[model samples]
Target chain A: MQFFIEVLLGGLLSGVMYSFVALGFVLIYKASGVFNFAQGAMVFAAALSFVGFQNLGLSFPLALLAAFTTMVALGILTERVVLRPLVNQPPITLFMATIGLSYVIEGLAQGFWGANVRGLELGVDDVPVQWLMDSTGIGVSSFDLFGAGVAAVLVALLALFFQYTRIGRALRAVADDHQAALSIGIPLQTIWRIVWAVAGFVALVAGLIWGARNGVSFSLTFTALKALPVLILGGFTSIPGAIVGGLIIGSTEKLAEVYLGEYVGGGIDSWFPYMMALTFLLIRPEGLFGEKHIDRV
Target chain B: MKNVIPLKKTLAAAVFSVAALSAAVGDAFAQAKEQFIGLPSYRVGAYAAGGSGLYGGWIDYMAMINERDGGVGGVKLTWEECETEYNNARGVECYERLKKKGSTGNSVFQPVSTGITYSLLDKVVADKIPMVTIGYGRTDAADGRVFPWVFPMITTYWSQATTMVKYIGAKEGGIDKLKGKKIVYLYHDSAFGKEGLTVLEKQAQKYGFSLVLLPVAHPGNEQQSQWLRIRQEKPDWVILWGWGVMNPTALKAAAKTGYPREKMVGVWWAGAEEDTVPAGDAAKGFTAAGFSVAGPNYPVIKAIQDNVYKKNKGNMEDKTRVGSVNYNRGVVHGIITVEAIRTAQAKFGKKPLSGDEMRWGFEHLDIDAKRLKDLGAEGFMPNLKITCADHEGSGLVKYQQWDGKQWKIVSDWIEPDREMVRGMIEESAAKYAKEKGITPRDCAKEG
Candidate 1:
């Protein structure tokens, strides 16, 4: 029973971390109709910048601010250079452009910060929380709990921002209809830059947490690949759906790998989540929380 | 009309200079005064930490030789590194791209990955080039009769695995103490990671120990469940056959599960500084099966420092990594390669030797302690001597423990059970030869 509880807690915490990255994809896709494939690259770039700045002798807060600013600038540049030019292209073209942008960003990140792995010290201790362990006999990593707390706070803040802010309204308008939003006076390009900037901020947070978990390296970009299944399950256009989908995928994969992976060759964690997402897709093509689109010729 | 004579004279002079330049260029090309070594390096990927140190040390040692002695026997050594990014396909592409370079073609090809080695085995054999996989590649390739072109020069994975079990036996007071012990093999889920399973299973059968197999997926980061299982099962000892991010992550998971880190031992590839440094202090007292010590105290390292770094010709961007574990492994690779070239030059004429000549040198290569002392690398590595029947001579391994900061040698050199390992190698080699329909060369018939 204690082992079961521990695995469940660990799975939930890991799910929250996945949700953090999935939220970045959800934020961009919600505002602009194009899927942002470069979210992982942005996470890698942000983490690299943070580590690089910290190595430059800056305080943690200052280094984080500098990294966040760099990500914002990157988001603005990406909007102006890549997305703005391909405004009215097909969604597939935009998706491909984002993929190309991911390569460019990855190259630029590694070019600026050499390709060596650097440890990111986020001050979150990875040791198990003593109180929780003593009380429930289930050891939960404090770092994981801290990461979950941060993710929860960020999600709440994003929810409030989308509900009350004027720019958030414009972002919604742009998501609803780009031409209609432009016709009204809500600048579609400006909304895109804002959405990208927000997504960049989310990437920064995701990068810091993931980097804190695993050392900052090029492999951090692979977290973006993990987020694809989350996006598929949660619906790319739904923020809450991303969070829920991430938790579901994360917990299910961990539970499945622990309970069932041994009967198979024991590496089911790699493909189990994707298989679950594929199964889910068969039932609902629009995803769990995605809006249904009716198309007529 | 008066100036026509001078103009014609100027034209003749220009033509003469062009002809002279072309002749000089042709002579330089024909001389073939340089030997080209192909380096399939990875500088950007999950395994970049290992790659940087390995390639950096290799380039530094070669540069040091050039700076100190102006090349081996007046023949300059040139090398071109193609980045493989630790991917098998890219590694093969790198091999193909670099094989055609240099004056007399590529002297040797070392792909540095078991998967890449497997992919390029037939290619290198067909191309008639020597492929040197120092401590990695097919374990059966140690039998040089079948794998004529492939050299697993240092130690095979089978030897390493058996040696690890031997070390465990020693720790438990005797080999008989291993009976009924639950030993877990926590390994990466790839060809390289799974290379030691057969050996471990055979050892288990012989020694009466239970073996548990746990495979970590590629770029292994999430392992909460795996470690939890280890915690529950409480294996007597865990042998980690992992690389790259998997090493540190495994250590972290061990710490999280409150498992004793000292009970776990990593393979040679998982013993580098990057493997443990990321885990911070939790990696203290972590043991690993190591072939070489990590430090700058070796004479060869000092020579490299004096010749390469002092002269600003060293390839490592980070000067501090000159004496790191993986870097030293790279230096050892460079030393063995240079020694092979020297051996070939001694046998053949003193000019640039071809790949076949290099193969001969590898077959007959002998690096005794005296040779190592002359090369300024005494006590840096075990004395190695390759023969026709055995490419991997005396698989010597040692245990190193990480004491929060660096790896320290904790045990004397231990030789793997050669009788058992050789039987397996010959059997596997015969299987490979039959599969390929290639005739095995008799050792007695060879020169």
Candidate 2:
């Protein structure tokens, strides 16, 4: 039972990290209706840029600021160069452009900062929190706890922003129906640029925390693979759903791997989440917080 | 005022320039004493860090030889790089594109990837090209009687596995003291990752150690469940058979779970500076098996530094990586390649050797301790001799440990349990030959 709790908590913590990356995707998909495949590459570029600036002896805050500036520039560039031209095209075409954009972003990141793996120090010690361990005999990393807190704060702020902010509502209006949103004085282009800039901010935060955890490298892009399942389990459009779905997926996969993995030959954690998300998709096509849509004939 | 040339005149000039350029390129490639090595490199992509270091070292070593030795037996070494991005399809495409390059075509092929090695296994045999899989390839290809074309030289995975167990045994006082010890085999879940399982299982059975196998998925950035289970099991030791990001991730996870870094050991693929430096202090005290040692102190490295880098003709942008594990591993590749060509030159009168001729050279290659000293690579790479029946001349591994900054050699060259490894290789090769409807070569018949 003690070991089980530890695994569950660890899984939840891991899921929070997945939610960090997933939040970036939700912002773009919610606003523009285009599933940004380049989110992972953006995360990688952001982190690499942060590290590159730091290597040049910049303080952490400066590096963060520089990296955010780079990401925002990248987001604006994507708006002007990629998405602007593909406006009103099929969603698949938009998706393909993001895929191409992903390669270009990856190339640019590595090109600017040579492809070398570098450790990130966020000054958060990764050791188990002593008080929690002593009280409950369960090991939970303080670094992980810090990461979860950051994700939670970001989620709350984004949730409130979408619920109340004028730009946020306009962004939602654009997502609901690009044509219908355009009929109003929403200005789809301005709304998209704002959402993408916001998405870029999310990507930078995700990259720093994730990069600090798993040394920034080309494989940091692979974290995007985990977000796909999270997006499926949660709604692609739901900020809160990403968190809830991450928790569910994270806890379940770890628990399953711990208890049931030995009998099933182990290493099931990778594919098990995908399978669970597939099952969830079958039951709730619109997802837990995803808005349901119906076209009137 | 500017005057524009006529369309026909401009076209004729462009055509003549292209024709003249082609002629020069054709004449340069048609040289009798030129040896070509088409490098299927991955300078950019998922595994680019390691790729850059490795191909950089390889290209540098070849450059040094040409600069220092005027090429082996007056045969100038030439190469072309084709980016594979570490993808199997691109690797194969690169192989096909470069097979017919140079005067006598490609002398030998080395893909530096297990997936690419597997893809070109049968093709190399059919094409009469000898492929060298220095450390990672078909372990069973060590059985040269059955696999005459493939040389998984120096050390194979099976051998490395047993050598790792031997190193562990030595640490436990002796092999006899390893009875009933619980050893965890934490491996990456890919063909390259799982290559050590069979030998490890065999070692476990023989030594009375409890071997626990845990697999991490590909691009293994996440290993929470696996590490948590590892913490639960409280195994005596953990053997990390990982690659790429998997290495540092494993190190970080172990640190997070309070697993002692000293108790964990990684394979050669996980032993580079790139592997340890990324995990920061978490990688401290972590040990790994290595075929070639790191450090620029070796005379051969100094030679490259003086002859190549000093002259502004070096391949690596960062010259400090001259003695890194991957870089030196690339140098080791260069040594064996040049030696094989030299050995063939001794028998076939120098000049550029064909792929078929290079196969003969590889089969008969020998680099003794004296030869190594003469070449100034005595302690950098192991001295070995290849024969018709033994493709893997030696199965020697040096253990290295990361002490916060860089790797330090922890153990002398440890030889694997070769007799047991050879038996397994023969059995596997025999099965493979039977499956392919091919007859094994008799060692006596080979020249």
Candidate 3:
């Protein structure tokens, strides 16, 4: 039972961090109606930039600010270069552009910073919380708890911003119909630039946490795989759904791997979440908080 | 008219210079004896740090050989790197691309990946090229009679696994004390990772210890449940058979679960500076197995610093990594390869040899303690003696522990239990031979 609790809490904690990346996807998909395939690469680039600046002898806060500035620049450049030309093209075309953008961003980061895995220090040790372990006999990581706290706070703040702000409403209007939004005097391009910049901030935060855990390397791009499942289970257009979906996916992922992995020769954690998300897709295509679109022929 | 006349004369002079350079290049190629070794390297990807360090040291050693000894028997070593990006498909494509390049058409092929090695097994055989899988690839391929085209040089996975057990036994006072002990075999969930489990399971049964199998998926970034399970079982030790980011992640996870780093043992792939440095303090006291130690104290290494880097012919961007674990391993690889080419030249000629001739050279290659001392790599790497029947020249392993900064040698050289390892190799190789319809080579008749 203690072991069970440990695994369960560990899963929930990781699920929270996954929501951070999922929020990045939600922002762009909700605002622009285009799936940003480069979000993962952005995450990798953001973390690499943070580490790169630190390596250049900047303090942690300066590195963070510089990395955020770089990310904002990357977002604006991506908006002007990749999206501006293909504004009214099919959604598939924009997604394809993001895919190419991912490669370009990866290549650029490699060129700018030499390809070497660097360790990241977020000042939080990844050791288990001693009090929790002593009291409940469950070893829960303190760093994970801190990660979960940061993610939850960020997700809640974003949820409120979308719920109350006029810009957020304008962003939604652009998503519903680009021409309709422009007809009502909403700036589609401005809203998109704002959404991507916010996504970049999200990417930066996600990268720092995950990079601190896994070391800043090319593998940072693969966390998008987990985020996809989160986006699928939670609505891609829903902010709070990301948190709930992350919780569900994270717990089940750990439970299934621990309980069922041994019977299947182990290492099933890598694919078990995908299978669960696929099952969710079959049950609710629109997801819990997702809007149902009725197409007119 | 005057400007046009000058233009024509300038164009004529440029064309003449080009022709002269081309002729000189052609003449140089004809006059100089050159051996080309195909290097399917990974220089820009997830495993780039290791690839850079290894290929850097390998290139430095070859450059030193050329600068110090005027090449092996006056045959200049030439190589072209085709980036595989650590992908198996790219690795095979690189093999096909580099197969027919130089005078002898890729004298030897060494793809530093087990996945690539497995993909090229049949292809290398058909091409009559000898593929050397040093410390990686199929363990059963150590039986040279059935696998003449492949050399799993130095040590096989089986040897490493058995030696790991032997070292653990020595720690436990005696092999007799291994009874009733429980060990967790935490491995990467791949063909390369699973190779060690067979020998470990057999050893578990031989001794009375119970073995628990745990598999970590590729790019193992998260491992909460796995470590939690380790805490529950409280096994005597954990054998970490992982690669890339998985190594440090495992160490960090172990620290998170309050598991002792000293109790964890990593494989050679998991033991490099790249592995430990990333985990920071969590990686301290972690031990791992290796075929070579890391240091720049060796005379060969000093010569490379003086000759290769001093002359601006060095390959490493980070000169500090000249004596890193992966770098030293690559130097060991260079030592064996250069010796094999030297040995081949003695039999074939002082020129570029064919792939088949290189195979013969590998079979006859022997580097003892005296040769190692002469080569200035005595303690840096173990002695090796390749035979017609045994492709794995020396199934010797050295253990090292991480002291927060660098890997410290923990034990003297330990040889694997050859009697048991050889039996398993022959058994598996015979089955493979039957499946592939390959007739085992008669070593005596070849001589």
Give iRMSD, candidate 2. 0.8
Q: Report iRMS values in order.
A: 1.4, 0.8, 1.0
The lDDT-based order of candidates, best leading, equals 2, 3, 1
TM-scores of all candidate predictions against the true structure: 0.96, 0.96, 0.96
What digit string (tens of lDDT, one per residue) describes model 2 on residues A1-297?
Answer: 888889989999999999999999999999988999999998999999999999999998999999999988898899999999999899999999999999999999999999888899999988888888889988899999999999989998998888899987888898888889989888988888888888889988999898888898998888899898898988999999899888988899899888888999888989999999999999999888888878899
- What is the Cα-based lDDT of residue A269 in candidate 2? 85
Quote the positional error of residue B431 for candidate 2 in Å. Answer: 0.8
Candidate 2 vs. true structure, TM-score: 0.96
Q: Find the 10 residues in a row with the least total lDDT in model 3 chain A.
A: A155-164
- Which is superior by DockQ, 1 or 3? 3
lDDT per residue, candidate 1, B118-186, as tens digits?
A: 998899888889988888988899999999998898788999999999989998999999999999899
Candidate 3 lDDT, B1-447, residue by residue in tens: 979988999999999999999999987776457888888999887788899888988888998998988888988888889999999999999999999988889988999999999999999999999999999998899999999989999989999999999998998999879999999999888887899998899999999999999998877887876887788889999999999889999999999988899988889999999898888889999999999998789988998899999999999887888899999988988998899999999998999888999988999999999999999998888889999899999999999999999899999999898999999999999999999999999989886
The residue-by-residue lDDT of candidate 3 on A1-297, one tens digit each, is 777777888899989878878889999999998899999999999999999999999999999999999999999899999999998899999999999999999889977987778889999999989987788887788899899889878987787778789987788888888999999999878888888988999999999999998888888888888888888899888888888888888998888888888899888888888898889989999876778888999
**Lowest summed lDDT window (length 10), candidate 1 chain A:** A115-124
Best by DockQ: 2
Once fitted onto the true fold, the runs of candidate 1 whose alpha carbons sit more than 4 angstroms away are B1-31
True contacts kept of each: 0.48, 0.73, 0.70
Native A-B contact fraction in model 1: 0.48
Top lDDT hit: 2
Relative to the true structure, candidate 3 reaches a TM of 0.96
